[model samples]
Target: MDIGKQIKTLRLGKALTQTGMAEILGVSKSTMSNYERNISTPDPDTLRKIASYFDVTVDYLFNDMTDSPRDIIKEGTAYHPDKALNKDEWNAISYYRRLSDEQKDFIKGQMIQLYQKSSSSNKG
Candidate 1:
């Protein structure tokens, strides 16, 4: 696993500067640079600190996976690469994501009722 690359990716993903991360970790900028550049490796204590700061586990930091923030999808989100949604559908999704829990439940109930009505109409 490329630990240096993982650290660099996490730091850049958070939009944090090397100097800023260095100060946060109580290390020198050169040390941070070195860590990112694969010139030196941080001890276990520092690894824990970095993991905590990045909201990731130490194993993840040292793991072979190339993690990126953009690659992580939010929960309850739907993604269909084979089918593209229309603008109205996209807008509805955006609006739904911004709605409160109660509003979502209300909308869901309304949708279920609409679907039932449409089904009955078609049956007739």
Candidate 2:
């Protein structure tokens, strides 16, 4: 199912009104309605919040799974993806993706050196 449909189904399964979800998510009721109706996609932070609230992964939110949306609740918890990446990590990734190839190579080398230094220090 599409993300909007999935969100609507999850909301209905939990018996939560759009207003209640908006309040909890710190968005306007109309914004919540837009999300359910697929008028707009949630930003990364809000997407993370929704996944965390439903105890599902960000990948689950993006993927089309079972024919039945309710199956998400039953199987969702079982399919845990990696722990949610934090804002700083996500920002770092976004910055990395925007870099030129040379910049990326430099950054990657720097990261590897940092990692090796930190690892050796920890062993010592």
- TM-scores of all predicted structures: 0.55, 0.53
lDDT of 1 at 103: 100
Q: List residue ranges in candidate 2 displaced over 4 A.
A: 69-124
Q: What is the lDDT of residue 83 in candidate 2?
A: 47
**Per-residue C-alpha lDDT of model 1 across residues 1-124, encoded as one tens digit per residue:** 7899999987886689999999999999999999998899998999999998776779878775553222233446875444545546644665786779999999999999999999999999
The C-alpha stretches of model 1 lying farther than 4 A from their native spots are 67-124
Residue 36 miss distance in model 2 (angstroms)? 0.8
Question: What TM-score does model 1 achieve against the real structure?
Answer: 0.55
Q: Which pairs clash in the backbone of model 1?
A: none
Per-residue CA lDDT of model 2 for 66-89, tens digit only, reads: 352322212456853434455466
State residue 11's C-alpha deviation in candidate 1, in Å: 0.3
Which candidate has the top score in lDDT?
Answer: 1
RMSD list, candidates in order: 8.9, 11.9
